[model samples]
Target: MRSRPVLVYDGDCAFCSSCVAFVERRIRPRCDTTPWQFADLAALGVVQQRAAYEVLWVTPDGRVRGGAQAVARLLLNAGGVWAVPGALLTLPPLRWIAHGLYRLVADHRDRMPGGTPACALPAARPPGPPGGS
Candidate 1:
C-alpha cells in the first residue's frame, strides 16, 4: 500500500506535463504526482495500456481512477471551493459530459498548447460488449 495517493501522467506529452504542473501550482492537491514512465505501475494497480491512454489517480489503498474520473478525484482531494465542481463531475449528466470532453481533449492533445508530436496518442480500440470478447 502507498503512503500517499499518486497522480500519474504521461511524461513524454508536453501538454500533459504542463497540465500537471498547473494542477500542482494552482490546485495543490494533497498527493504525489509522477509520470507513469517513472512510477511503479504494478504497485499502483495500474496497467500500462491504461496509463498510456489516460491520467490516473491511485489511492493509498490501491484504488485507481482514470481519465476524467481522475481529474474529479484530484479536485475532490483538494477540497475547499474546488470540491463543488469535483463532486459535480462525479454526478450523472455532468459526469457524462465531463467524460466526453476529456476524451475530446485527450484525442487531440497533440494540437493543444505546449503539446508536441509526442503528445499524439495511439488510436484507441473500440470497447467490446460487456462480459464478451
Candidate 2:
C-alpha cells in the first residue's frame, strides 16, 4: 500500500486554514495534513521558498508537488468520486488551464473570503529593460 502523503499549508493564512478545514470535514484523504509552521520542513526536504509560494503535497517517496498539482494529487488520493475530477485536471489542456487558474487565485488570495493581506503573494519584481540590462 502506498503511504499517506503530507499536505503542507500556510498556517498564517486564514483562507488556507478554512480550506484545510473543508478538506478535513469533507474530502478526508488518508494523509497527514498540517500547517507548514508546525512541520519540520527541512527534514521533509521542503524548501521554505517553495512553501511560501504554494501549498505542497509531499508524497511518501519524498517527491514534492505544489500549487494546482498538489491539489490534484490530494483529490486523487481522496479516491471515490474525487478521483475523476482529479484525474481530469491532470490531463493535457486542462492541466495547463488549471495551473494558470491556480496561480491567479494564489496571487489574489488576500482578496478572497477568510484571507488577509498576509495571504498575498510577495511583491513582484518590477519590469526592467530588455534582458534585465
Candidate 3:
C-alpha cells in the first residue's frame, strides 16, 4: 500500500480541476491528487459510477470518503492552521449544511466558474434485466 492518501476528482470538469489546483497550491495536502479519468479505480476499490458523482478521498488504510467528507478529510490531512476549520466543518449542523452545499455545487457545476457545458455528467444507464438484455 502507498504511504499517502489519494484525492480523486473528475478530470473532465474544469471547475473541478481549478478546485484541485487551489488545494494543491494553497493547502499543500499530504496526498496524491489525481483525476478519475487517469486513476486506477479498480486498485483503489472505487466504483466508476460513484466517482462520477463526487470527489473521493481514499485513505492509505483503504477507507473512502466522498463529497464534503472528502473535502474535510483533505483539509484535515493538510495539518496546521487548516485543521481547525476542517474539524469545525465536519461537526453537526455545519456538516449537514456543508454536505447540502457540496451537492448543490456538484449538481450545477457546469454553470459554475471554469466549467463549461461539457462539464455536465453523462446520462446514467437505465437498469436492465437481471442477467442480460
Off by over 4 Å in 3: 123-133
Model 2 alpha-carbon miss at residue 83, Å: 0.5
What tens-digit string does per-residue lDDT give for candidate 3 at 88-114?
Answer: 889999999999899888888899999
lDDT of 2: 0.85
Task: Put down candidate 2 lDDT per residue, 18-109, tens digits, no spaces.
Answer: 99999989998889988888988987778776787789999988998888899999999999999898899899899999988988877788
Which regions in candidate 2 have their CA more than 4 angstroms from the true location? 124-133
State each model's C-alpha RMSD to the native. Answer: 2.4, 4.3, 3.6
For model 1, what is the alpha-carbon lDDT of residue 94? 96
Q: Estimated TM-score per prediction? A: 0.93, 0.88, 0.90
Model 1, residue pairs in steric clash: none
Residue 83's lDDT within candidate 3 is 90
Top candidate, metric TM-score: 1
